[model samples]
Structures are given as C-alpha cells and as structure tokens.
Target: MHKFIVHGGRPLSGTIKPKGSKNEALQVMCATLLTEAIVTINNIPDITDVHSVMQLLTLLGVQIVPLGKGSYQFCAAHLHTDVTLTEIFRQEYAKVRGSIMLLAPLLVRFKSVSVPKPGGDRIGRRGVHAHFEGLERLGVTFCYNVDEEAWKAKCTTLSGSYILMPEPSVTGTANIVMAASMAKGKTIIYPAACEPHVQQLCHMLVAMGATITGIGSNILTIEGVAHLSGTVHTILPDMLEIGSFIGLAAATKSTLTITDVPINLFTPVWSCFRKLGIRLEEDDNSLHIPFQPSYHIQKEIDGNLLSLSDAVWPGIPADLISIAIITAVHAHGHILIHQKMFESRLFFVDHLIEMGARLILCDPHRVHVVGLGNAYRLRGTRMSSNDIRAGITLLIAALAAEGTSTIANIHQIDRGYEQIDQRLNALGASIERA
Candidate 1:
C-alpha cells in the first residue's frame, strides 16, 4: 500500500554514493554457507532483498551480528541441516528469489536440502534448470515434492566435472562455482557469466581458500579443495544504482557527482551513455556527470540509427534498458532499444508513452524511441511499479516530469534501492513516501 509522491521538474544537486551491489551481496551472502568459520562481509546493501537473504541465513542457524552499518559477521559453525523442517523457514524461503542460491552451498556442506520453489520479480520466467543441471553433474539428485512445493536434493558426494553452461546466467554461474569449489576433482566451466558481480563472488571464494583461476574471463578453471575457511570480503558498489543515477541526472538536467564508483566495471554502461552524448568525467574512483542542457544520440559510423541491446557480460546490461529509455526522452535522436533477456520487460514503456515520450513499441522485446530532446517534458501521471527496474525508471521520469506524480507499490523499488527517496531528497529533489 506504500506510494511515492514526487514533485516533478526539480533540479537536483550534490554528490551521491552508490550502495553495494545487490546481486553480489546476495551471491556472497549465500557463499557464506560454504564454511563453518566466521565470515564477515562489508559494504552490504541494506535493502529488502539483502534482508531477506539474511533472514534465510538466520533460519539455518547462522549467527548474525551487526558489526556496523552495511557490515555484518556471519558464523555457520552452529548451522543446522534440517532447515526445511520448520514451517516458518519454508514460508520465508518461498518468498525470495535468493533462496535458490542456498541450495548449492547447503548441498556442499550437508549433502541434502529440501528447498521450495523461490519467488521473485515477475519480469519473466527465470528457471533454475541451469543451476540444478550443473549441480547434478556434481553428483546431485533432485526430486520435486508436490505436497510441499519443494525440491528435495541429495548428493552422495561431489565430483568436479566440465560444465559448459547452457547460458551465461549470473546465479547459475555463481551456484556452479560454489559447488565446484569443494568438489573432489577439477572443474572446467566455459561461457560463465563474467559480470563484475560474478567476478566478485569468485574473488571472495578464492580468499576463503578455494583455488579458482581466470577470475575475470568467462572461462573459469576450479580445482576442488577439501576445505574452505571463512574470510572477510567487501562487495563492489552497486553498478545498477550508478547507472540509475546517471539516467536521473541526465533526464533532470542536473549536475551530480556519484562518488567512489568502480569505473573499470562499467565499460558497457559508459559506452551506451556516451552514445547518447551524455558527458561524463571520470576520476580514479569517482564519476562526474555534468549538467547538460541537451545531448544527441550518436549514430553508427555509416549514419544509421544507434542500436542498444543487452547481451552477455561485455554488452549493455539489460537492467539499465528502462532507465536508458527515460534518458533517451531528453536526448535528441532515434534509437532502437532491444530488451532480449526478458520477454515482458519492455511492456513498462506504456507508462512513459502515456507521459508524452515519442516512442514506438515494435514488439515485446523492442522499442523504437524518437528522442524529443528538450522540446517536451513528460507530464506527471499516476502509475504502478511492476518491477524493480521499472519502478526506478518511473521515479526518474516523475522527477523530470512537469507536475506532481504518484508511484504506487514502491515496495518493489525498496527491494533493490536502499533509501532511494531519502537519498534523492537529500540532493534537493522532492519525494514523499506516503
């Protein structure tokens, strides 16, 4: 029932720091189950999804003590294996997508797990077949328990084997990496997701005494070890959050600096934004997005319309497509937006089209946008946030719109972005959480 009351057309100023990567934090949180020692993680985002993962850990008897803001200590020393025996655990486990990550780690430690089908964003059908298929190669067997709506998984033992990933899925890659870390033999994985978050997970696992090679590349060679000890790990700053801020500053024509950004992890993002002619300055660890009255979309070398598509790690992230669509509203030119990852992701463009953006819906996966430049400002309207990415996109559109706007079901936004309204309001933007 929560909603965000936003006043449009407010110029924003000041520096904003992005939170830790939600994807990395979630993956690393699940990785903690790999060892029995105390594992301390820093720079964890205080968002709903992170909190949900923490709850799942606690239900499994992991001792959680808050060290400081965005820092916590986790010890699985007293962890119990019969977690699904509790009704509360099953109920809570079924509510978060992150619960799927628990399977690989628990299977490595206890060799048996009863995990319910996970719930998460309804953007599209995100199946766990890859995760299980890869784990099954490690000597795991799965049975679906229709009565409990859960999957009963048991592993006699783990044996590392060559796993050519069906696709470069982030969670699937992470799950396989974790299971292979403790397997008995050598595991070779190719076409693995090499996204920054996935790399961070591999790096963290390595620090915990696992032998992993090719940390940044898609192909990873893992030598299974007998034991893994706990270690302290810090997550990278949220790249999705950084991209959202860039889109917001561009749409609002504001000069804002996002501090302490990992510019090295954002090659594709920078390329796409530059293609829109949005000027950005980079320091060693920070990024400066200057205020520009207008910008243009740069076409191809042969003067064709610019095309932005989401692909594997080296390509533009699909998560930013919605925000890019909003940024394109203020830039002058035509571009094709292809959201090939999820069939239903581009459907949220209807709300922006209603707000006066000159966009054509080519299909469920593509949108042709004719950037109106600064000639038109989107008029405020009431809308519902259907997913995390769509919610942030609406917030950006509302902030740069002409009047007052209402965004309902803001819980979707809270699942990923931490204190987004308060943070933006701190920079002189008006956002009321009602």
Candidate 2:
C-alpha cells in the first residue's frame, strides 16, 4: 500500500542504470525447467513479477539460490513435482502475462500442465489460442471445461511441425519456442515476434543446449533436444525502462547517462525517439541523454502534425505508448498518439489532462497532445495507477510538473521497474516512497 510523493519541476542530472529486462527474466526463469544442470543468471530485476515466478518455481521443487544482488543460481535438476499447488500458484501466476511462458517448459518436462488465465494490462482480448494451436501442431492435447474453470494439457511426446502464428504475439511465440525446444522433431515458427526480449530468450535457450536458428527474424527454426544443460548467462538491460528513462529525462530537462543499454537491441526505439526531437548519443553499450533545448514533435507527410502510433515489435512498442503521450506534453509541437494494440491504454490521459496538459482523447485508442511548450508548467495532482506503463508515465509527469504529486497503487509500478523510486532518487529526483 505504498505511494510515491514527488516534488516536481526538478531536473534529473546524474547516472542511472536500468535493471534486467522483466520480460526476458520471466521467460528465462521459466526456461530453466528444460534443464537439470545449474543455470546462473545475472542482472535479474528485483520486481514483484520476478518474485512471483520464483515462488512458482520453488513450489515446483526447483532449487534457487540468491548468489548476490541481482544474481541467481537455479537448478531444476531435482524438480520433483508434476502437479503445481494449484490453489497457491493460481493467483500468483495470473498476476502477470509472463506466467503463460511457463506452459512451454512445463509441457516439455512433465508432458502436462495447467495454468489459469494470465492477467496483464486490459488492453484488448489477448487470446491464448495461438499458443494452444502451436502446441497442438506439436502433438499436445488440451482438455478443459471453460465453464467449470478447469483446464489441463497433456502430451505423450511432442513431434514438431510448422506453426504459423496468426499474430506476432511475443509471449505466445516464446511459449511455442520453449515447447519446441524438447520436442521429438524440428519445428518451424512463422511470423514469430522478433523483439529483443524474445531473441534473448531464444539465445539463452540455445546456450542451455537447445538448437534454435533465426535470432532476429520473424521465422524461427528450433531443433528438439533430449535434455538441456544449464549455462551462465547475463540478461539484457530493460529496453522499456530505457524508453521510460528517455522520456523522463526529456520531460524534466534532465541530463542522464544510462549505462549498459544494449544499444543494438533498441534500434527501433532509438529511431522513434529521434522522431520526437530527442537527441541521444550511443557509446559501446550505453545511451547518453543530454539536456535538450526543447522537445518538438515532427510533422507528418501530409503537411499536418502527426501522432506517434504503437504497433507490433520492430515498431514502437505498445507498452511505451503511455510514456510517449506524457513526453508529447512536454514537447514543443502538436502530436497525435495512437495506441493500436490496447484499446484501454489511452484512458490514462485524463490524469495528465488534470495536470494542465492540453490533450484530446479522440477515442479509447487515440490521443492528440498539443504541447504546452516552455511557456507553461504543468501543476502536480494526485493520481492512481491503472497499469504498469501508465503508472511510470504518471510518475514522469509528476516529476516534471510543478508542486508535489502523490501517486498511489505504486505496486503496479513495482511489478516492472526494480527499485524505481530509489533509482530516480539517485538521479536527483525528489521522490520518496511512502
């Protein structure tokens, strides 16, 4: 029940390092189920979702030891349970979308798995039919009564085949890859998501003895292996966090150096920020954000100002659309933001509007932000978080606004960002956790 009370209008000027990617950590942790050897993972984010996944792994009899801060050694060699404690694991697993990633590894090891409907942002109808269909092509059988809320899946052995995903759902593709890793034959996945997180998961699996080709493309070829031996791997920096930091620095006129950014992983994101008139400098593996003279929105091809729109992977990510909306408010031009992935993501714009932002909510998925420019300062106001991205976006707005702002339901923010208040405080942000 903690909240963040932030005094706004402060320029954050310092060095900040982002934690491990939450998306990669969750899937990589679940991928441990495929191996019996010790796997060492570094740069793990200390977030609630990661804790929940660890709890689920512990319940399944996997041995996990915290070697040091942000480092963990996991060995699933002694995994002794085929049936998860349903009552205990259900609620925790449903709290985040990454929970669905457990299905693939579970199916490979135990040949049976039952997971409750995963919970995530209420953006739209995120169907698991793709996962089931992909698994079904590999000889998995699903049996459950939807009305009774009981679901189970079992497969004697999986034989790989071609799986053409209807959409490039990131988690769904990861699930299929995990399932295919230990199958009896080769599996080809088409139109798969090539997001950096997904590529990281695939590379980790390959490092752990899985044979996966196609590291950064839509089509993936996975060769089945009988067993996997664990290996030491380092998780990549959080790109979503990097994007959030970029928005925060620009909104607050801060100069920040984000270390270990994995610049190659965020090429599309970097391009998107450039279009917003935010300057960035990339070193070997870090990104430097200098204090900008002004943030301005680029014009459209039709000679009219256009909004930033979110699409699938390789385009702007849907998770950062909210952050972009807040960034638009501090820019020097008019821009529209269209959230095509989730219908409800744009609903949080009202909270920013209360802070004196000139924004028009065109619909559930569209917003028009007319920048207040440097002439006006947004006034801080109290806000409650509705989702992970929105929560951080509100915090960014609060940091850039005048006066003090209190953000409640910070647990939503904690689910993704690791020690966010502490990290921002280190960067000269006057934020305190209450």
Candidate 3:
C-alpha cells in the first residue's frame, strides 16, 4: 500500500506535458496479435495497465522489444501459444478494463481464448455482452463457466455483417474493430465509439493493411484483409490527462503550456469546458491553459440551471466526469453532474463534502455541486481513493485545500497516471509519495 502526503494550499505553477494515452496504447498492443509482422508503437504511456498488456502479449509468445522509454516494437509473427496465461496475469489484469481486448485477437487467430473476468473501476456494471454480441455478429461463439470464473470464445472463420453495439463502449468498440479487421468481407458498425484512442487504433489497423473508413464518425466500415503487416504508429497524447491538468490549473490558478496536445483531437472536449467558463488557447501542436476568471456553470437556453453530463465520444467522456465535478466545486454557480455511464462513480463526492463542498447527491448517477466562488478554500483532510479518476480528483482537491492532507491507496492512482506525484512535484506541488 502507498500513500500521498500532500501539504495543501499551494498553487502549482509551471508547464507540464502529459504522458501518452493509456487507453490508446492498450488497444494498439492488442491489435498487434492480429498481425504477424513487427509493429512499433511510439509515445506509449508508462502505466501499470500497459505493462499488464505487455505481459499478456509476452505470455502469448509475442516478442516485445524496447525501442526506448515510452517506445516499443512488438512482433507476433511467430507466436505459437494458444493458451492464454490468464491465471498468471489475472490479478494484474483485474486492475484495468482494457485487458478484455485480448479476447478478440486471440479468438480470431487461435480460434479460442480463455480469460478470467476482466477488472477495472468498480463504478458500475460493465457488461461483456457488447463484446460477445459484436463478435457473435462475426461468427464467434461464447461459453462461460461460472464456477471457474472464466470465459471461453471460439470461432473458425468470422463472417462480417452489421453490428449495432448496445452502448458506445470504447473497449467493446475496439474489440469489435480488431475482430472485424481480419474477418471475411466487409463489416459495418453503428453507434460506435469514436474517441481519439479508438480513432488511433483504427488508423493503426489501416497502416497495417486493414481497410477502415469513418475514422472519426459513429459509423465504421472495416474491410477484411487476408493478412496485416506490422507498422510504426505513435500513440496520441492522453486527452484525459490534458483535461485533468486544465482542471488543475483552474483550481490552483496556475498557467500551464502543454505541448503536442493534438488540438483537433480535443475540440469537443474544449467546447464542453468552455461551457463551464474554462477558456483554453490552442496552437498547431500545443495548448496553453492560462489563469482564468473564477469559474461558473453556464445557464441553459431556457434560463434554468444546466447540468454537465457525459456521453459517448464527441460528447463529454464519462471518465472525466469526476474531475469536472471537482472543477465545478471551485466555480461560481451550481451545476448537476450526471454520470450516466456508471452508477457508483458519484460516491466519491462524499469526500469533497467533508472538505466543505456544497454538494447534493441526487442519485448514484448524479450530483449537484455548488461552487464556493473563491470565498472558501477546501480544508485538508485524510481520504481514501475509491477509483482512478476519483483518486486524482481527490489529489487535486487536496492540493487546493488548506493545510495537510494524506491520501491512501495510491496504487489506484499509479494504475493510470505515470509518476503522478513526481510530475506534480515538478509543477511546484508539495506532494510526497511514500
């Protein structure tokens, strides 16, 4: 167990670049199993989830060579193992949801994949039915043994068709895309998740000789290919991290210049932030978050209070809803945060309430936060992290609070943010990880 001991009431001032996207790197790595050629991925995030994916790949007989820090060359060309070492990696994989992606590639190439129940944030019921349902559209059969707590899916040749996902689940969409890329004929996916990470995986597949249209749209067209060769691709910057930093700067009144932000990748995200009174500046390859006025929630067109809710890609991300909630606490007016994607994600607000936040928990999926408007600073207090995003949001609140605060169970934070304590320390934040 690790903890972050933070001396609060300090405004972090300096520039910091976010690490690569963890979500993107996981999908890219899983996509490698679809091909026999060497795939080189750059800008990989040095996070626990990624390392677990790498471990899973190695267990499947793929050779992963380190090109440098945050870079790797993966070759599954000679992979011979059919048995997924799920038992060895089960505990680790249980820490991140992206581990479920292994099923598609394994089922495609080897005909069978056995995996333990995938684990991630305990936010809500994340069903694998989307993945199974989508893959079944391509001729895959699934069997689950409840007593063993494992699932096995097998398929011969996948026949492509139209797949309408129950929800725009990001990992589910990636699994389907990977499976469809190698199936016979063409496959169409409707109501797909078009997040930047999903887009990057689609582009990487295309670079490896897979045909995929509708790069940034809800409808995706993937034409099956006989074979795919390895190619070099760079993972996109972590937009979630970028958004978190934006919130951090606003909460602490700091100016931060983030480089290589992939500005176009974040138009919708920035627009959502603007609705909350957080303004951002963009350049060709960078984004600047300057000190702004005290934040406030915008009113609705009908002159009623509006709530900030998360949806699929193009809409606000559900993962950032917690950070948005914390940002709203420091803003001027009250706003509702509807975490439609998850049930328990809003439970972390109780910690904020302890720090003197004016919040009303409407339900498991919604909360209303009324900002203190710079009139009151959150008082420091001991807390525990319940999930990744909430953990980071608590850290942010701790940094903005008065006096000292201790956060336990920091491994939850390490699973997502790489060297978060060190990175924040570099930005003049008084935090120690022990």
The regions of model 1 sitting more than 4 angstroms off are none
Clash list (residue pairs), candidate 1: none
- Residue pairs with colliding backbones in model 2 are 307-336
lDDT of 1 by residue, 1-434 (tens): 99999999998999999999999999999999899998999999999989888999998999999999999999988788787668888888876787788889999888998988887788887889889888988899999989988899999999999997888888899999999999999998888999999999999999999999998899999999998998999999988999999999999999999997988878888887898889999999989999999999999999989998888888888898998899998899999988998888888889998999999989899999999888888999999987899999999999999999999999999999999999999999999999
Distance from true position, residue 432, model 1, in Å? Answer: 0.3
- Residue 30 in model 2: lDDT: 90
TM-score of 3: 0.97
Which candidate has the highest TM-score of all? 1
User: Model 3, range 228-273, lDDT digits (tens) per residue?
Assistant: 9989999888989988888888887778888878887788778777
Clashes of each: 0, 1, 0
Candidate numbers sorted by lDDT from highest down: 1, 2, 3
- The Cα error of candidate 3 at residue 94, in Å, is 2.8
Model 2 weakest lDDT span, ten residues long: 78-87
- Which of 1 and 2 is ahead in TM-score? 1
Specify the poorest-scoring 10-residue window by lDDT in model 3: 80-89
RMSD of each: 1.0, 1.4, 1.3
The lDDT of model 1 is 0.91
